[model samples]
Target: MLHVTTYYDTLKVTRDAPAIVIQAACRALMQLNHPDNFEGREYEAVKIAEDLREAFDVLIDPNTRAQYDNWLAKQMEQSN
Candidate 1:
Protein backbone atom coordinates (compact mmCIF):
# COMPACT_ATOMS: atom_id res chain seq x y z
CA MET A 1 0.00 0.00 0.00
CA LEU A 2 1.09 3.54 -0.64
CA HIS A 3 1.69 5.56 2.49
CA VAL A 4 -0.01 8.92 2.75
CA THR A 5 2.01 11.77 4.16
CA THR A 6 0.34 14.06 6.63
CA TYR A 7 1.52 17.52 7.69
CA TYR A 8 3.10 16.05 10.79
CA ASP A 9 4.88 13.46 8.68
CA THR A 10 6.02 16.12 6.24
CA LEU A 11 7.68 18.03 9.06
CA LYS A 12 9.14 14.81 10.54
CA VAL A 13 7.43 15.61 13.80
CA THR A 14 4.82 13.94 15.94
CA ARG A 15 1.20 15.13 15.97
CA ASP A 16 1.61 16.46 19.51
CA ALA A 17 5.00 18.04 18.82
CA PRO A 18 5.43 21.57 20.13
CA ALA A 19 5.66 24.59 17.84
CA ILE A 20 9.38 25.01 18.42
CA VAL A 21 10.09 21.42 17.40
CA ILE A 22 7.84 21.76 14.37
CA GLN A 23 9.66 24.94 13.35
CA ALA A 24 13.02 23.21 13.64
CA ALA A 25 11.80 20.23 11.64
CA CYS A 26 10.40 22.52 8.95
CA ARG A 27 13.71 24.33 8.67
CA ALA A 28 15.59 21.06 8.41
CA LEU A 29 13.23 19.74 5.73
CA MET A 30 13.33 22.99 3.80
CA GLN A 31 17.09 22.90 3.72
CA LEU A 32 17.12 19.31 2.56
CA ASN A 33 14.49 19.91 -0.14
CA HIS A 34 15.63 23.38 -1.28
CA PRO A 35 15.46 23.72 -5.05
CA ASP A 36 19.03 24.93 -5.31
CA ASN A 37 20.18 21.80 -3.53
CA PHE A 38 18.92 19.67 -6.41
CA GLU A 39 20.03 19.63 -10.04
CA GLY A 40 17.76 17.96 -12.58
CA ARG A 41 15.03 17.56 -9.96
CA GLU A 42 14.95 21.24 -8.95
CA TYR A 43 11.27 21.63 -9.80
CA GLU A 44 10.24 18.70 -7.63
CA ALA A 45 12.47 19.93 -4.83
CA VAL A 46 10.88 23.37 -4.98
CA LYS A 47 7.41 21.90 -4.75
CA ILE A 48 8.33 19.81 -1.73
CA ALA A 49 9.97 22.80 -0.08
CA GLU A 50 6.85 24.89 -0.64
CA ASP A 51 4.71 22.16 0.86
CA LEU A 52 6.94 22.10 3.94
CA ARG A 53 6.54 25.84 4.31
CA GLU A 54 2.76 25.57 4.07
CA ALA A 55 2.68 22.76 6.63
CA PHE A 56 4.83 24.84 8.94
CA ASP A 57 2.47 27.80 8.63
CA VAL A 58 -0.61 25.77 9.48
CA LEU A 59 0.96 23.64 12.23
CA ILE A 60 2.66 26.56 13.93
CA ASP A 61 -0.59 28.39 14.46
CA PRO A 62 -2.42 27.10 17.55
CA ASN A 63 -5.97 27.54 16.24
CA THR A 64 -5.36 25.97 12.87
CA ARG A 65 -3.28 23.18 14.37
CA ALA A 66 -6.10 22.29 16.73
CA GLN A 67 -8.54 22.13 13.85
CA TYR A 68 -6.16 20.04 11.82
CA ASP A 69 -5.60 17.70 14.74
CA ASN A 70 -9.31 17.16 15.02
CA TRP A 71 -9.55 16.39 11.35
CA LEU A 72 -6.66 13.94 11.58
CA ALA A 73 -8.29 12.15 14.48
CA LYS A 74 -11.51 11.85 12.51
CA GLN A 75 -9.63 10.43 9.56
CA MET A 76 -7.89 7.84 11.71
CA GLU A 77 -11.16 6.84 13.34
CA GLN A 78 -12.73 6.34 9.96
CA SER A 79 -9.80 4.24 8.73
CA ASN A 80 -10.08 1.83 11.63
Candidate 2:
Protein backbone atom coordinates (compact mmCIF):
# COMPACT_ATOMS: atom_id res chain seq x y z
CA MET A 1 0.00 0.00 0.00
CA LEU A 2 1.11 3.53 -0.65
CA HIS A 3 1.70 5.74 2.38
CA VAL A 4 -0.39 8.88 2.54
CA THR A 5 0.64 12.07 4.28
CA THR A 6 -1.86 13.98 6.38
CA TYR A 7 -1.92 17.38 8.05
CA TYR A 8 -0.22 16.05 11.16
CA ASP A 9 2.49 14.55 8.99
CA THR A 10 2.87 17.87 7.22
CA LEU A 11 3.46 19.62 10.53
CA LYS A 12 5.59 16.76 11.86
CA VAL A 13 3.28 16.36 14.86
CA THR A 14 1.39 13.49 16.44
CA ARG A 15 -2.39 12.97 16.55
CA ASP A 16 -2.85 14.58 19.95
CA ALA A 17 -0.11 17.15 19.67
CA PRO A 18 -0.70 20.49 21.38
CA ALA A 19 -1.33 23.63 19.35
CA ILE A 20 1.96 25.17 20.48
CA VAL A 21 3.87 22.19 19.17
CA ILE A 22 1.94 22.29 15.93
CA GLN A 23 2.67 26.00 15.55
CA ALA A 24 6.32 25.52 16.29
CA ALA A 25 6.66 22.65 13.86
CA CYS A 26 4.93 24.63 11.14
CA ARG A 27 7.18 27.62 11.79
CA ALA A 28 10.32 25.50 11.71
CA LEU A 29 9.30 23.77 8.49
CA MET A 30 8.22 27.01 6.84
CA GLN A 31 11.53 28.54 7.71
CA LEU A 32 13.37 25.74 5.96
CA ASN A 33 11.07 25.90 2.93
CA HIS A 34 10.81 29.67 2.68
CA PRO A 35 10.87 30.90 -0.92
CA ASP A 36 13.62 33.42 -0.24
CA ASN A 37 15.80 30.65 1.11
CA PHE A 38 15.31 28.37 -1.91
CA GLU A 39 16.08 30.92 -4.68
CA GLY A 40 16.04 28.91 -7.91
CA ARG A 41 13.50 26.52 -6.45
CA GLU A 42 11.19 29.25 -5.19
CA TYR A 43 8.11 27.75 -6.84
CA GLU A 44 8.69 24.37 -5.20
CA ALA A 45 9.44 26.01 -1.88
CA VAL A 46 6.25 28.08 -2.12
CA LYS A 47 4.20 25.00 -2.83
CA ILE A 48 5.61 23.26 0.23
CA ALA A 49 5.14 26.36 2.33
CA GLU A 50 1.52 26.55 1.19
CA ASP A 51 0.90 22.96 2.21
CA LEU A 52 2.50 23.61 5.59
CA ARG A 53 0.35 26.67 6.06
CA GLU A 54 -2.82 24.74 5.21
CA ALA A 55 -1.89 22.07 7.73
CA PHE A 56 -1.12 24.68 10.34
CA ASP A 57 -4.46 26.41 9.76
CA VAL A 58 -6.42 23.21 10.11
CA LEU A 59 -4.51 21.84 13.12
CA ILE A 60 -4.46 25.08 15.05
CA ASP A 61 -8.21 25.45 15.22
CA PRO A 62 -9.96 23.33 17.86
CA ASN A 63 -13.18 22.75 15.92
CA THR A 64 -11.50 22.02 12.60
CA ARG A 65 -8.92 19.90 14.35
CA ALA A 66 -11.63 17.83 15.97
CA GLN A 67 -13.33 17.35 12.62
CA TYR A 68 -9.99 16.40 11.09
CA ASP A 69 -9.26 13.92 13.88
CA ASN A 70 -12.56 12.15 13.29
CA TRP A 71 -11.79 11.96 9.60
CA LEU A 72 -8.28 10.74 10.21
CA ALA A 73 -9.51 8.04 12.56
CA LYS A 74 -11.90 6.80 9.92
CA GLN A 75 -9.17 6.79 7.31
CA MET A 76 -6.85 4.78 9.54
CA GLU A 77 -9.53 2.26 10.37
CA GLN A 78 -10.30 1.77 6.72
CA SER A 79 -6.63 1.48 5.81
CA ASN A 80 -6.21 -1.38 8.21
Q: Estimate each model's TM-score.
A: 0.89, 0.91
The sequence of per-residue lDDT tens digits that candidate 2 reaches over residues 1-80 is 65899998888899989999999999999888888898898889989988998999999999999998899889888988
Over the stretch 1-80, how does candidate 1's per-residue lDDT look in tens digits?
A: 33678999888899889999998999888888887888899889988988898899999999999999899888888787
| Candidate 1 local lDDT, residue 70 | 94
lDDT of each: 0.88, 0.91
Q: Pairs clashing in candidate 1?
A: none
Among all candidates shown, the one with the greatest lDDT: 2
